[model samples]
Target chain A: MTITDELLRNNEQYAAQFSGPLPLPPSRHLAVLACMDARIDVYRALGLNEGESHVIRNAGGVVTEDGIRSLAISQRLLGTEEIILIHHTDCGMLTFTDDGFKQSIQDEVGIRPPWAAESFPDPFDDVTQSINRIMASPFIPQKGSVRGFVFDVATGKLIEVTV
Target chain B: MTITDELLRNNEQYAAQFSGPLPLPPSRHLAVLACMDARIDVYRALGLNEGESHVIRNAGGVVTEDGIRSLAISQRLLGTEEIILIHHTDCGMLTFTDDGFKQSIQDEVGIRPPWAAESFPDPFDDVTQSINRIMASPFIPQKGSVRGFVFDVATGKLIEVTV
Candidate 1:
């Protein structure tokens, strides 16, 4: 059986004890932008229960245009106020460069990607970068408390980055 | 105290019980693209542990160009072979059209957004659209097991979209 089938079975188990239909808006009035790293589970790391916060994630958690789009919707439509940015130590984004990644894809596919891969050199700097993007965006309101942190995968501690 | 402080306390607790750093690549070789809805915890819903799969999320779970970028990275560098796309019922994406959302924002901010809101009328059709986007992208090499599902908000169950 495929791993997808295995996860489907797991979903059946999840649904068996699941109690939901929570309100559409996040109850905590918070939103988090985190990396799509397999090692960091956003909810458990933040002690979040279901429906507590809106969680947006991508490859580097770099707050790309799409991240702004998600955050804008979270604050404008949903009732999220505070924003959290989580990048992690030992992130894959740190291992590569944007130009090299795009070029590799272009060499293989014969057409260069129109977008940057958003590779970053450091998680701490990228967290600050993400916060700055949110602060600079006219689309995202309620930026009074946007904080950024680097999650240490080994210790599972969140070290805030003061920019 | 700010909710960020509250969550920082929670992170301390998580760290107290934390385990060591896992491998960078996903153990299951899987990737999940999901909505940034508060109620749907992708790891819990799929019964995935840390380091098992990459979870990429955004506002509508729509496969935008960024999603393609992430999936390409996941497959090319990270070795993820399976992909799962998740959209949910009662999603905010269903509440408005792209033009209306951008127009409202433009009316308030005096500059229209260059990106579409990616609002959709139905979760099922959007799941198909997401699947189609993945299938059509050449950057993402693995198309054999790209499955899409509509997460039922009330039921907390994943319903596969047969597209």
Candidate 2:
């Protein structure tokens, strides 16, 4: 997809403001797992500058197999010792049932999408649970810390749910 | 990092337009790994409407170990078959040496961050090299497709560098 002229201009301006490589502050080198929903501006939500944290986003901000693997690598190799999983209210992942979603696409397209596994996974309700699962998984670095939160889309407020 | 009132109003308008799950036409579920630069608008860059694709962002958009892991799950479990890796020009990841970064942060925060690895990794001149590394990584699903591009912050243009 091509970027809109307005967005292109905004990025140009943003790039112009920073002169050097950002200093990765000692207490702020975090890794965040957040929803892909357009409403969530992770940088603003976390009070972060461009390079302070690494933000990973997916449909529900849920930690799936790949999420776990990435978390493992982030802790073990990418210099991320803390993880914040940010799920949010009014999340699309919570709105549709798995079968309903698959059928909706199937009706529009002839083939079923491959990732339509055995079930539709709701990321909002499952993020905290997913965090626990990830922290317990063998892949995560033993010393790394993982926390979870729910961002209020309506108010743009972040409330820590678990640590 | 609070979202501006203008953004919130725009988001509300955008949300009002979609009342239900939008259909994902064939090959519509694009998976993109982009940098977490606030300048980059993943939706606008891709001309994406609500619920069109899954965007996974991180520092530099470099397909680090975690990026691949997330890609694997996105393809294998989240209905994403195509991958797009977007790295931009004038990236913060390029500016500082590891030592400079660490020292800058320590001087400001007093404590060293736990994830402080040896140094900051640069993927600037090695755009093609970085893409190849991801395309070759085992963490990505074997059956899925992968592509990479470099977004020029100066021009607001995305140049397809590899496939």
Candidate 3:
């Protein structure tokens, strides 16, 4: 069976006890952009529940044009005010570079993508850079509450990164 | 005091109970692409824990160019074989159009972005489209295990979409 079948069976149980219809805007007026790493549990690590905060994640949680577009809507249409960027230790993103990865894919598939890998050497520095990216975004409003953190995957702890 | 301060204070308590070193790759070998809706508790809703599934989320989880890049790396390098696309009802993406949103931003900021909002009217159809996008991506291998679902924000249930 596909994972879809398994998850559907699981959702049957979840729906049996479903309790929802939460508000549209997050209660905390906050949004988190974090890595897609499996080891970092954004909600549990940050003590968030449903309807509390918006968790926007992607590889490395790097601020991209698409991310900025999302954040723009999150602030303009929704009511999110604070932006938090979280990258994690032992992230797969730290394993490769843009040129190196593209070259590898080119060698394998005979096609080079016109996109970026957005890899970084250190999670700490990446977080700082992401924080600055969001802060510097013309789309995001005047919220000086932008910050970044390095989530320790081994320990489930978040370490703040100053920019 | 910013939200950063509050989160940092919370992280201090969480780190006190730190346990070190989970493996580098996800244990479940699954990757989930979903919306950044505040009401969807991805981990709880899907019964996922840290170190299980790689969750890639953005505004609508619509499988952008960047998302494809991330998924390619996830499968090629991280050993993730299955992918699940989850979009939810009452999503903010349903509430706007690219042209309209771009015009609004241009009015407000005097600079129009070169990005698309990637808005969709129906979450179910959008999920299917995303699944097709991933499956059609040349970078993604012939996994044939990709699936999509529409999560009920009001019911905490995920309904599978047959594509």
Residue lDDT tens for model 1, B7-33 = 999999999999979999999999999
B8-76 per-residue lDDT for model 2 (tens digits) = 344445445435433432135557788755455565555554455667776567565445545644554
Q: Candidate order by DockQ, highest to lowest?
A: 1, 3, 2
Looking only at chain B, model 1 earns a TM-score of: 0.99
Stretches off by above 4 angstroms in model 3 are none
- Model 3 global lDDT (CA atoms, 0 to 1): 0.84
- Pairs of colliding residues, candidate 3: none
Model 1, span A16-97: residue lDDT tens: 9999799999999999999999999999999999999999999988899999999999999997999999999989999899
Top candidate by lDDT: 1
Candidate 1, residue A120: Cα displacement in angstroms equals: 0.8
Q: Whose DockQ is greatest here?
A: 1
Provide the lDDT at A78 for model 2: 48
Best by TM-score: 1
TM-score per prediction, in order, is 0.99, 0.56, 0.96
lDDT by residue (A1-163, candidate 2, tens digit) is 3323333454455545535443333235456778765556565455455445666676667676546544544554446667778887766565456666555545654545455322224444476677778766655554345667776655555555643
Per-prediction DockQ, in order? Answer: 0.90, 0.11, 0.72
Clashes of each: 0, 2, 0
Worst 10 residues of 1 chain B by lDDT: B135-144
